[model samples]
Target: MEAPQQTEKKRIKVGIPRALHFYRYFPFWKKLLEELDAEIVISPLTNKKIVEVGVTHGFGELCIPVKIYYGQLLRLVKDHPDLDFIFVPRYVSEVKDSYFCPKFLSLPDVIKILPGIPKILNFEVNVKEFPISTAAVELGKQLGKGQNKALNAYKEAQKYFDEYHAFLREGASVNQALRLVQIIRPFTLPKKKSEGDIRFLLLGHGYNIFDTFINLDFQKKLKDQGVNHITIENLPESIFKTPVIVNPRGAKLQNYWRHEEEIMQAIRYFLTKGRDEIDGVIFLISFACGPDSLIAELIMRDMKVVGLPFLEIIMDEHSGEAGLLTRVESFVEMIRRKKKGLTVGRRNKLTIKSA
Candidate 1:
C-alpha cells in the first residue's frame, strides 16, 4: 500500500525510488531536502504489478530491483506528473564502506530507455577529490535555489545528517529516526519477544530489504514469528571498515559478481561472530542475478554438509504472493523443528508455493 500523504504543501515534491541506496541515504536525503525546504515523496514499496511494469520497460537482463525502479518511475509519471522534479542521484564507486554496484551506477543512464521520467535533480558524484558539498551546491544551482540558499541548505542538511547518523550509530534503529521526526514509522524491527531469541542471517542486496513488496511481506512474517533477522541495511557502513577486508585485488563491485563477494565476506563475519546464536541463513536474491547464482551455490555447498538449514528465494516481478509466504513458513517450521531436536527429515528445498 502507498504511504499516506503528510500535508498539502506547496514545497517541491521529490520522488524517490525505494530501491538501491534509498535506505543508506534516505536520512541524508530527508535532511538535505528538508533544508532545501522541499517535500519528499517516496515511491511505494515494490509489488507484482510494479515489477511487471518494470520488466516491460527495462533491459531484459537487469536485476529485479532495477526493473522495480522502472515500474516506479512509470507510476510516478502517471500518478504525479505535476511534481516539480524527480531525483536520480548519480553515484559512482565506493564512497567509504558504501559501494554502488555497477547497476546502480548505470541507473540514470538507463532512464532514457523508459519514457516520461521527469527532470532529474542530479548530484552526480564520482571519485575526483571533490567535496560532497560542492555537488550539493551544483544541485542547488539546478533547482533554482540561489547559490546562497543552496549553500545554507547544504550546510543545514549536512548538520542534520550528522545528527541523524549519530543517533543510529548510538544504536538507534529506523524506528528511532521516525520517532525523532515525530512521524509514525511505516515499518518496525522485530522485537525480542520471540523465545530463546532464535536468530537468522538475512542476505540480500541493500535494495531488496527496503522495498516492501518485492520481498512479499517478508518483514511482517518475521515480525509475526517474532524472528530477529539482520539485513544488510541494518548494519552501518562503518561496520565494513578496516575490520572486514575485501578481496585482495580489490573486491570492487565492477558487476554483480563483486557485490556477491562483499556479501560473502559479510556472511563469514556473521557466521564467525554469532555462529552458535544464528539458527540458519535466509538468502534473498533477484530472479535473474548472476552473482547471486554463484553465491547461492557456494552457500548451499558450505551449509549443506554442516546442516545449516539454508533457504534461498528468487524475487521476480512474476513471483507470487502465496508461494513466497509458503516458502517462509517452511523455513520457519524447519528451524522450529530443529530447535526441538526432532528426527531428521529432508529439508533445505525451496518451498515457494505459487498460486
Candidate 2:
C-alpha cells in the first residue's frame, strides 16, 4: 500500500508597521522574517486620515510619533486580515547606560491589548539579558520552525542588516538602501556640491526626521534650496556606541538617553572635525518630548559657546508647512550670509510652530 503524501504547510503571513523603529531597522526585520519563511506586509505610509484615526482612538497625551504608531497598528488590522502575527519587538536596551523610550518598551503590551488585532510576535531585545541570536530561535520555534532553520534564518538576516549599514556608511540614506535591495533603483549618493554650496547637519529621531507627512517633506525642501545635509544615522555606528565622555568643565555631559547619545555624539563629531565643511545645524524635535527638552538646552548652549549657527524647529500634528517654510528660508539665508562672512545678527532663538 502506498502511503499518502503529506501536504506542505502554508507560509505564515506577518505584518510589520512602517513607522517608529521601522525607519531604523526595517531591513533587519524584513529579512529576518523572510528567512523564517514568513510573508511580510508593511503598513502604508502615514497620511492625514491615519493621523485623524490615531488622534481620535489613541489614549493619553501621547507624542505625535506614538500616535502615528497606533495608527499604523490599526492599519495592519484593517488591511491584513489574514496575517497570522505582527512583529512588535520590545526594545529595552541596545547599549550600556542607554535605554529606549518608555513608549517603546511598552509598545508590544499596548498593541496586544488593542481590539481586532492578530497575535503579536515579540521578543525582548535587551543585549545585556539575552543574545540577539536567541530572538531568531525563539520566534522561529513559535512559528513551528526547527532550531537549525531558525539559526540559519537569523544568520542570513544579520548579513543583510550589515550590508544595509555598509550602504549607509557609504553615504546612502536609509530609504535608498532599502529600495536598492528590492531593485527599486540603483544606489546613489547626493549630487556633488558646487562652489558656494551649503552643507548642514540634520539631527533628530528617525521616526520624526524621515516621515514625510509628519515632517512636511522638510528634507525635500532643503534639497530644493540646493542644501546638502548629513544626519546622525549616516555616521559610523562605532562613534555612538563608545563610552560616554565628560568634558573637563563638567558642564558638558553625555546624555544617558539612548537615541539622544547618538545625536550628541554626531553633533560633537561634526563640530570638532567637520566644522570647516558644515555651516550650521538644523535640529528637528518633536513636541512633548521630555528627553529632547533637556537635550535641546544642552545643544543650544554648546553651539552658542562654539559660535556656530543653529536653527531649532519644533513640529507637531498642528504644524503648518507655510510658516515652517518661512523659518527655513530665513535660516538658510542666515547660513549663506554667515558663510560669506556677512554681519548677520544673532538670530539664536527656538522657533515654535503650532497650528
Question: Which structure among the candidates has the greatest TM-score?
Answer: 2
Per-residue C-alpha lDDT of model 1 across residues 1-355, encoded as one tens digit per residue: 2344555336778777766667557767776776777777776666667778888888777887888778888877777878778888878643543445677777887786678778788877664557677777888877667777877887887776676666554444543454454352433333434353567777877566546677766766776776777654445555454333333476743322435656776566555554665788888888777768777887787677566888998887777888988888888877987788776445455677999
**What's the C-alpha lDDT at position 87 in model 2?**
85
Superposition-based RMSD of candidate 1 using all C-alpha atoms, in angstroms: 7.8
Summed backbone clashes in each candidate are 1, 0
| Residue 348, model 1, lDDT | 55
Off by over 4 Å in 2: 1-6, 181-196, 246-254, 342-355
Clashing pairs in 1: 323-353
**lDDT against true structure, model 1:** 0.69
Model 1 ranges with Cα > 4 A deviation: 1-11, 96-99, 146-152, 162-197, 236-238, 243-262, 297-307, 344-355
* Candidate 2 lDDT, 143-165, residue by residue in tens: 88888998898899888888778
List the candidates' TM-scores in order.
0.76, 0.89
lDDT of 2: 0.81
Q: Under the 3 Å rule for N, CA and C atoms, how many clashes does model 2 have?
A: 0
Q: Which window of 10 residues has the lowest lDDT sum in candidate 2?
A: 1-10
Best candidate according to lDDT: 2
